[model samples]
Target chain A: MAKTIEEINEKIKAGKAVVVTAEEIIDLVKQKGTKKAAQEVDVVTTGTFSPMCSSGAYFNIGHTKPRIKLGGGRAYLNDVPAYTGFAATDILIGANALPDDDPRNRVHPGEFNYGGGHVIEELVSGKDIRLVATAYGTDCYPRKKLETWINIRDLNQAVLFNLRNAYQNYNVAVNLSDRTIYTYMGVLKPDLGNINYSSAGQLSPLLNDPYYKTIGIGTKIFLGGGIGFVAWQGTQHAPNVLRSDNGVPRRGAGTLAVIGDLKQMKPRWLIGTSMLGYGCTITVGIGVPIPILSEEILKYTAVSDEDIFAPVVDYSGAYPQMKSDILGEVSYAQLKSGMITIQGKEVPTASLSSYPRAVEIANLLKEWILSGKFQLTKPVAPLPGVESGITFKPLKERPIED
Target chain B: MVVSKRIVLHFPRRVVERPIVYRLVKDYDLEFNILKAFFTPEEEGLMVLELSGEQTDYDKGINYLTKAGVRIQSLSQDVIRNEERCTHCGACVTICPTGAFELDPLTRRINFYNEKCVACVLCIKACPPRAMEVHF
Candidate 1:
């Protein structure tokens, strides 16, 4: 009863397609097994809405009335800096960029209140943001400065060109220090008082499509509110991470460089967030529809919170550190239950990733599939899935200047 | 006639040294849970407390506190979740100290259980849409 992509599309065309969410697919497979579930479910919709630091939006600001050349350093949008290095009018805004008057250090250690992420959120929410730029009056461009307000509608081309997203999997964080640590992972209560994780678990796109055969270049997805595509293999895509018998990555693996038209996105699907001490990040809402190609694909979609696990690491030191405190493996279900025993102490668990939003995105994609409004893309290029040893190295470890 | 209510209890300096909270349970036969407590250097005490018991015992507990100069205020106060603004992302579900927020497994919707909310305000800032608001 293995279904092909064409067969699924035919079912969708006939308006008789059976679609299930990543959560529902879990039960369907557990009861009927992969073969039966593959026959029953044609598509499994997955989603995740979490803060991704490697995200940015580009805009073709078009020609200012006097053709002002943006000379890089002095340009801002709604009090947030825009990378003017792109072109005279075209500018890029990184989600993590902070405003000049943010008053970060002026306050307590962690409280980075707002910046580019907030501006992006406001823009998506359909609010106007001030756009200011200055360039020493160039003889060729002939403009010194410009200051105006622009909304998404005014821009000729506004696109969300995120470089990295849909992280295959992530770590669970626990702070063992005496003081509360504010991190992009959320506020960590000290003394292993709490644990915070940031994955939608079963609903996450990369989790459902453990192997990128079904989710690769040109794969259609729900980016923000509008349909988008996986532009490329995301930066730091380690297709080579170790996997469980289930074929799901056991560590950080592949990611996505997603892109979508800004005009088609909704404010609810995107947000700007400020971590009190951890700076800023844009919470991106992404949903990818996984068409059940066969029994194998069905099994991947069946991953549940109780099934997928992450290691708990200590954030008291520099992050992304390979060494972990080895708090042991725990499932998303236990984490969501609100507490887990770390070092024999009952520590509360929290998640920076929003499950409700992820579910909403999944359901939204489901509706699109049922209504035949969205079509699933067969990957043109397969993403790497095996263990790749291509470790990025910094140019020569810093040695004494001999 | 058992009931539960959340209230803010302020103890003056003179009463700070007294074990009034312990006395409420021993003398009045009432149950109390302290959600938060702040003991000032000046010996003043502030607490967000929930008390439960039979109507008679609860009344006696209130009487004992008032007679001892403990000022009390009810916490009808709550955090407001703007229905229009909430996208039901379930971000608050995991962070709530009191398990006030949870996702409905069947519908995949975030449910706010007010009865369990201690108003720690963790979700207020966590809410991306600025949907969760606190009103004390």
Candidate 2:
């Protein structure tokens, strides 16, 4: 027997049924409306914490590895920091320290992308990895050197999408006609001090779609217009294929690749292999760890105080339901009194005027969904602005609330 | 010991048209302290400066710039301020790519810490009033 609407509703409520198509989503949205549509179905939330950082590990990796504490070394001498303490061959790994004591486990910012289960496997496997991808809303001017860098330290395969290469060759694009024609030149590897590949000479790696277009002397490259480029790369390549310039087996193959300004491609990463004849492929060599040199010590300094401070905030069980899919489509005007929460505290009881920010954030959540940039499984709370004024003020004098 | 330091500056030509004719002077009156600022003739929009302060002062300024919105870039030592529009609200006081700006102790005016700015546009974008500009 076919399932009745009530049975379907119960199944969805119990998280047994999944909406597979846009039509189903529309039907569900129409049936329940906005608020309840969320509750009827599974709504994932994510919370973010300010990152915790260290000065950096100083080390030298030859046949034998030697390590040194970064804090105890001479900062600079004769206008140059001495590199005598360690070799430049050390691999500097940026790490995020999770709060071990807190029962409510939350990932620190920049350490991992968001979306999906909070479990380590889910995060490492790249499920629901959170990201904030933005495109120029209105046709605006592009810059000649608006560079974006994605440092690939590990060969971990993940889904990468929403790629765009914008150009500001001219000062500004006042109108669609005035838009500078962007002629996407070739990609470059400054480390190699040479061009890697050219858009003209290389086969168009761009996924053929109307949204992807060239404008203003081909100065700006917008994929899918606001539409973006998506690709996946992860095939078992030969382990020792990649090596250092000296030809020694420094590290594994396909571990690091830097994407300069390519108006034709969006900056994204996705796990899995590509369908035949789609997306450009690039190989990265994880080469021997670059030793930490004395002169380069300052480069690793955590200039911002944030690099030293750990966040004091925490996130827990839902105190506010930003929206209730079960409530059906309620207009913003109908957004009830108690639909959102923060830090495990209920919204209504807290009676904080900042609750509206949650609503503003709800709109951001909807936009995140439409962008298809990431599917989150944790509470991705926006990092509230923290003030670290120039003049040092004690905690009591600081303008912030824990 | 005091010495005149040689500096090479790359600045925008439109605002700083005459590099040689116009001396690079900071409102704070910083001179004979192992620091000198000058606009370069080769690059109209570029300025070069040399500063000799107790090393810690440089570090503090660089830290301030990184926090206030200055972008620390690789490849070159540069400070690029776009003059097309400068609201001068003082966000750059903290957002300098290298912590190059300071509030004058008495006048409360913005002072340039030439050796500290790294040319990051964090302040330029953060400026709600849209007064400052960053080139690189």
Off by over 4 Å in 2: A1-402, B1-19, B22-136
lDDT string for model 1 (A166-210, tens) is 898888888888987777677777788778888889899999988
lDDT of all predictions, in order shown?
Answer: 0.81, 0.23
In lDDT terms, which candidate is top? 1
For candidate 1 chain A, which ten residues in a row score worst on lDDT? A387-396
User: How does the DockQ of candidate 2 come out?
Assistant: 0.02
> In angstroms, how far off is A387's CA in candidate 1?
5.7
Give model 2's clash tally. 98
Q: List, residue by residue over A270-334, the lDDT tens digit for candidate 2.
A: 11111011111111000000011121211121011111111111111110222211211111111
Could you say which candidate leads in TM-score? 1
TM-score of chain B only, all predictions? 0.72, 0.34
Q: Alpha-carbon interface RMSD of model 2?
A: 20.7
Predicted structure 1, TM vs. truth: 0.83
Give the CAPRI rating of model 1. acceptable
Instruction: Give fnat (model 1).
Output: 0.32
